[model samples]
Target: MTQLNNVGIIKKANIYFNGKVTSRTVLFPDGTKKTLGIMLPGEYEFSTDLKEEMEIISGKLEYKLSGHDWVTIDGSGIFYVPANESFQLKVHTVADYCCSYLNE
Candidate 1:
């Protein structure tokens, strides 16, 4: 296993949805790879390339999975977005969030 100590702020990332989404690749302690993201106020559509995600921070959000019902989230919460599922997120206000991806 490997470790990162006192790492600084992110320097590289990809932006989507007119800057509503930002993605960055990071290395984990177990020597694995992960992708992290930050979503701001806007409407967005995404599909996961991995099996699941673990939310690190959360706030109010509106979402809908492909062909599924829409839902809203409030406060700090953690949830999973299944792999290969297309989903959309609509932010009512400014929000800060992060999530860890599985299998890249």
Candidate 2:
């Protein structure tokens, strides 16, 4: 989906990597949450406390999960990061993404 509807967003931004990466917390009505964010051209590493579904909305980038090779996702794609793991990204362009925190 291009847009999110009927959701609550936290006002404060999630800033990281000296503001190279940022996102907002999106609260859903069904006790679920997600993050809508953007990544500028840079390399970044992130750790997840929960299982996350990373949906690439636009732009180009390569991501590497723990114990996996770097995979490129250009234009749009989806990848999952397991709970309690780390991942890396090489953002080639400004990328828009939506990350869903999954329970299973």
Candidate 3:
């Protein structure tokens, strides 16, 4: 696990999947924003308005980018979701992740 230092004010947020997934928005002192969330075992599709980097903190998930093959991601793994695109994820176990919205 990567150590995070000084994560600033965090505010809770209910994300998509009809509240199946929940996250907390972290506002850093450096003006960066991130969403830390957990996903229960299920299949879900997500759309991104901004480019995102999703890091798997624990458990595992199988995900397929748009027009790409499914790949399994374990703990500490990271994946990128392009802006204005969507991806599908199939979680077999409870997975925890951090999504960092990139400034383009």
Candidate 4:
């Protein structure tokens, strides 16, 4: 997770919730993609097209998947979001994260 080698990054950011959330798309050679982003304190709901592995680099937040209870991720943690579904987040502090999109 320290370095991303041989990858392409999109120049524009994916901005959401009035810029409270922002991320840049990183494209890998194997046709996989990931997003590195920062989240400011806010509540947000997101829909996913591909399965996602979200790794929190720092800060605190709570996430809720469909049919599941809210789970807290403080300091650093990782969570998975299934494809073609939605999830919610309540960010308590500024958080840095990297999300890897899975083809499977």
Writing each residue's lDDT as its tens digit, candidate 3 over 27-70 gives 77788888889999899989999999999988789999999999
lDDT (0-100) at residue 16 of candidate 2? 90
Candidate 4: lDDT of 100?
A: 95
Point to the candidate with the largest lDDT: 4
TM-scores for candidates 1 onward, in order: 0.73, 0.95, 0.87, 0.96
Off by over 4 Å in 3: 1-6
> On a 0 to 1 TM-score scale, where does candidate 3 land against the true structure?
0.87
The model with the greatest TM-score is: 4
Which parts of model 4 have CA positions greater than 4 angstroms off?
A: none
RMSD of candidates 1 onward, in order: 4.3, 1.0, 1.8, 1.0
Which pairs in model 4 have colliding backbones? none
Query: What tens digits encode model 4's per-residue C-alpha lDDT throughout 3-61?
Result: 99999999999998889999999999999999999999999999999999999999899
- For each candidate in the order shown, give its overall lDDT on alpha carbons: 0.68, 0.96, 0.87, 0.96
| Residue-wise C-alpha lDDT for candidate 1, range 1-104, written one tens digit per residue | 33445443356887887777777767656655555677777787778877666463556788787778887778656667788887787877666665666664
- Tell me the lDDT of candidate 3: 0.87
> Model 1 reaches what TM-score against the true structure?
0.73
Please identify model 1 stretches exceeding 4 Å from their true place: 1-10, 54-56
Best-to-worst order by lDDT is 4, 2, 3, 1
Candidate 1 residue 95 C-alpha distance from true site, Å: 2.1
